[model samples]
Target: MQRLFNDCIYRIKALGPEDSTKLFLSRAFGSTNGSCPMELEDAMKKVLKKCGGLPLAIVSIGSLLASYNSPESKHMWERVFKSIGSEMESHPTLEGMRQIVIISYDHLPHHLKACMMYLSIFPEDYVIVKERLLMRWIAEGLVAEKRGLTSMEVAEAYFNELVSRSMIDRAADIVNYYDGREETCRVHDMMLEVMVAKSLEANFISLIGGQYEVMPYDRVRRLSIHGGVEASKQSSFKKTAAGRGRRKNINAMNVEHVRSLSVFELEGHKLLNQLGEFTLLRVLDLEDCKVIGKKHMAHVCRMYLLRFLNLRGTTITVLPRELGDLEHLQALDVRLTFLEGLPETVTALENLECLQYSNKKDYISDGPSKTA
Candidate 1:
């Protein structure tokens, strides 16, 4: 195999000590060169040695230590160094690198940990929109209110911190034109692997479609269905006798405890009809889903605890007049849909803080308008 594709192959080697140290410092302290205070130099050296000149290990360990880079936090730095156990020495390959990344995850703050694990809900290589993600986080109660900061502000800080730590990467060339701020991000593949593993271990989320087709054994908490061509094929096949059994199994799954449900493709639109089953749901994100019409809004109106509802890019014509019954609704996004207009009942939503919509002329509403 190597002989046949020798010309196409490129052998990438690990970074040298000098370059590794530079990368580590750049990530740890945002320094151009490998520079640190005298108090932290010893601790940094001890941790860098274990990285074995590998870029991934260095970045992971460096970002983990960034929070403890102050002179007063010398003991914390030493503690981090000691925590990189003997497994790193025993397995000095990809396993060791995974261990390094897991260490970084292990050191995240409790709220940040929940937020990070939520990234696993997205499909592999999916570009996540910052505003959409923050709204969901807020609806899921993952973002705690600070003394002076709004919940959205706190969630933004959580996102920036994750970017700073290299847990998620800011998408290049994808800036919001209005504010010139980062609007999209993608999780690193390795970091995403860690997140998915951790999410499953804790039963934090239940996934369907995509690479994961089996139903989870535990009660659903947060559900994400990533549909694609395969799911479309499976949906068609469900018309057969064998497929009917599978469909029944899916319909029987409990969703009463689910707080958030996000479906990414048109194939999963059938699940939207069962919204009545998600009694405690707070977020219902069905971005870009097609074939769904105003008939489904009946189930949506029944969700009294819903805080965020996204039907962007769907084929819905209008919302139900009973939409006002969702007293806890805080945000509603219908951008890029075929909706003619919002119902007058929308005005009755005292808690609605964000009402995003677009008209036939493609005129988008400004962000967070309560009066809409």
Candidate 2:
């Protein structure tokens, strides 16, 4: 916290308050060439010259002052009425961009506002993966579901809209499909941080729990539970996984509220034996989890509608013969797992096109490696 504060202070010092203020005005008031008519541009540029080139500093100051009485707007406008020329320069850090985002974010619809801020979980400069982010959003009940589309598909559409408006950035990650659909994506480093921080206050994001929550599991589509032991809180026991994977809240059966489950991140969590029956589950991520016994595999196989399944970095020796049952699966990220062979059942997936990890040591298949 101190480091971040110090960095901000240092950057501020570098800009020097007066010069930074001049920059701020240009970003907020001076018209960018394409944005406004020449008549308006000339006047706006003078206003911006008052604050040098710092965009964010100007946004904060402007937004704060913009909301006051009409008299205040008049006062600021009068100052602009007198000004000079285009003096605002590009900002040195992302703080200014973030401030502009915050200003715009404050104007979004209440729900969309929450959704936008929740994306800050990944590392800065991280290219956002669409499937993974969408799942978290669905699991949180942030979007309404449609009848024909699977929840994962529904989640992805929302992500597209956010990116289209520049609310988020798209990654250059590409997975050229046999059908030629450009289904790959990613987010910028600084923007990712902005989204994660927003998640804290909005509860807009949830992580697939791992041993050391370092990098978020940005792989699944609709719902990811932190698959760790903290998941089974025996000490403060209240509900089990049997009934809709939710609690009755004995006091008010009418107003049922369920605790959001997180995917356990511990290595042993990979060994799925008896998964808690969660009919309400939207995204299930087993990407870096280590232990996966036969029982867990069977339960996972039967999860008919699972949209995203990640077996990446797991120590599974091979896929169970029952691995091909997920007809509704969209993405199967099996990268870096210890599996030697794939069950022919995998061929049953008409929709499975994104299989990764073909260069490992083993293969339990009669045919050539599909991953290669």
Scored by lDDT, the top model is 1
Tens digits of per-residue lDDT, candidate 2, 32-90, equal 23242344444444444443444443544343333332423454554433332222233
The lDDT per prediction is 0.77, 0.48
* TM-scores for every predicted model: 0.85, 0.50
lDDT of each residue in 138-160, candidate 1, tens digit only:
98889988899988899899999
Q: For each candidate in turn, give its C-alpha RMSD to the true structure in angstroms.
A: 5.4, 11.0
Off by over 4 Å in 2: 1-36, 42-52, 55-99, 106-166, 169-204, 207-274, 350-359, 362-372
* Model 1: how far residue 29 lies from native, Å: 2.0
> Where does candidate 2 have its weakest 10-residue lDDT segment?
249-258
TM-score of 1: 0.85
Top candidate, metric TM-score: 1
